[model samples]
Target: MNPRRQVTEHLLRTYKSALIGFAGVFVVGVVIADIVAARVADPAPGIWMYVAIAFRYWVGIIAVIFISNNLRQFVAVGVTRRDFMAGATAVGVLASVAFAVFVPLGHGIEYAIHGGSGFSAATGFREFAATLVSCLASFVAGSAACAGIYRFGAWGGLALVIPALLPAAAATIFLTTDSDGQIAADHLSFPLALVVCLVATAAVAVLSHWELKDVTIRRSALG
Candidate 1:
């Protein structure tokens, strides 16, 4: 296997337990909620919609750990900084895609559990697309934030905070799902919002690479 592919697999293996736990917990919780809601009131918009929203935040934290914690460890193991960033980026995007697929699929399962035909093809597609881009934005933004803090001191990192968070913030503000599981954007067209989010995410991912590529790994107490 290629070095980058090996790094990607290694990172994924390290995160496998967390990833499974995340999805498993969400699944169990949503099922319980659906049953309770069916007994009391109709569950609006399905639990998966809310799960989709949480996915971005969850992946964002993962991205931070991928950089702040894993970067130095991977580099110490003879991996190039460039390869580490590439592998991490690939992992982030793949994780986002997985959540995107899961959200819509879970929505359908929620409908099945509720004994309701609440699932709509159009809504599912909208949810999938929105979640994918938003999570991507969140992941990349997190990477940028951590890269800034890792390469520069805390004070210097503060300077890049706003721009580093722009993609995730904008995605959260614009692409929103309603109570009925329908997605809508605040100001821009839905498609346009996705495009802008993708562009911003790409830019920030590049910036994170630039910041991390030649980063100086400071000595720690363990070493």
Candidate 2:
């Protein structure tokens, strides 16, 4: 089978199960956390509870990406670098769109439960864009790492994801945890995101060259 079809089919099959599990887990976790927080602190609606729910989904998105990458290896079937990059991007983009809606919706939920809005629509949109970039970075890195693993077994390939994640992670820590509310890079971070992208591409290229050098090209043989 062609790499495109192979990757797409695998992604669909894997993520379908992931979606089911995610809904069940996410909903249950959120509800439990919310209930517990309500009992512990503030009277009626709780802002912290809503924030917790939002953070849970944010983390959930990353978990899905990681699982999909690991699943690529767990399955006996082979996947190409092109397949990994392309397929993972599609999934990441879908998740990014969800994040776009989720952030604002969470804010809206907060407004409904609590009295005033903690953030304005514009700020929410900015954060959404940053979050999208983060997800994209993660997807590209994940696919590259998976491709490397497919070529070099486990340890060597796993190293590939690290370089790709560094800059993006640096960007994440700086923007996410800072007291300031800006999205633009600061000092060294100005080139951090770009560097990560470049490193990730290099890793993908190296591993992919090896993987394609002697393609196993699985055949549908005698029945």
Candidate 3:
């Protein structure tokens, strides 16, 4: 097998249990939320929408923490930084895509149960693309923050997190509307938001590579 593929597989395997657990929880949570919303006399649009959005952000933050904590183990196992980064990036992108699909699917399921009481889960292909790009950008931003912490410790990590988070924040703001039903894309066009998301993803990847390329793995105290 290719070294990068091996690394990616290993990383995926390491997180398999957690990912599965998250999926199970998300599904159950959405179902419960829908049930509660159904009982309400005046349920708002997209009753389960917040649940879906929260999951994406949760996954993003968790992805970074997982990568940061595991980098040393990968290095100890003789995986080159470049290969590890490649594998990690692949995993992040794939995971983002999976969630992008799953979130809307979950919403659709909820919509069916609720008799389509809310705004369409994902109205069009443009919305779906935006969701995917937003999720990907968020993950990349998180990875960049993790890389910063691993490379430069806490204070340095704090300094780096701002730029790293901007892309994800921008994507989120532009792609989503407030609870009041004001569409963000109305202010900033969908195409422009998509462009920003892509740029942010690229920038974070570059930043992560720069941080990890010459990094020294610290020996764990417990080891």
What TM-score would each prediction reach against the true structure?
0.92, 0.58, 0.87
Error of 1 at 6 (Å): 1.3
* Model 1 poorest ten-residue lDDT run: 214-223
lDDT of 1 by residue, 77-123 (tens): 89888888778888988999998898888887777667543678997
Per-residue error (Å), model 3, residue 101 = 0.6
Best by lDDT: 1
- Model 1's number of clashes is 0
lDDT: the better of candidates 1 and 2? 1
Poorly placed runs, candidate 1 (over 4 Å): 42-45, 115-117, 220-223
Can you rank all candidates by lDDT, best first?
A: 1, 3, 2
**Sort order, TM-score high to low:** 1, 3, 2
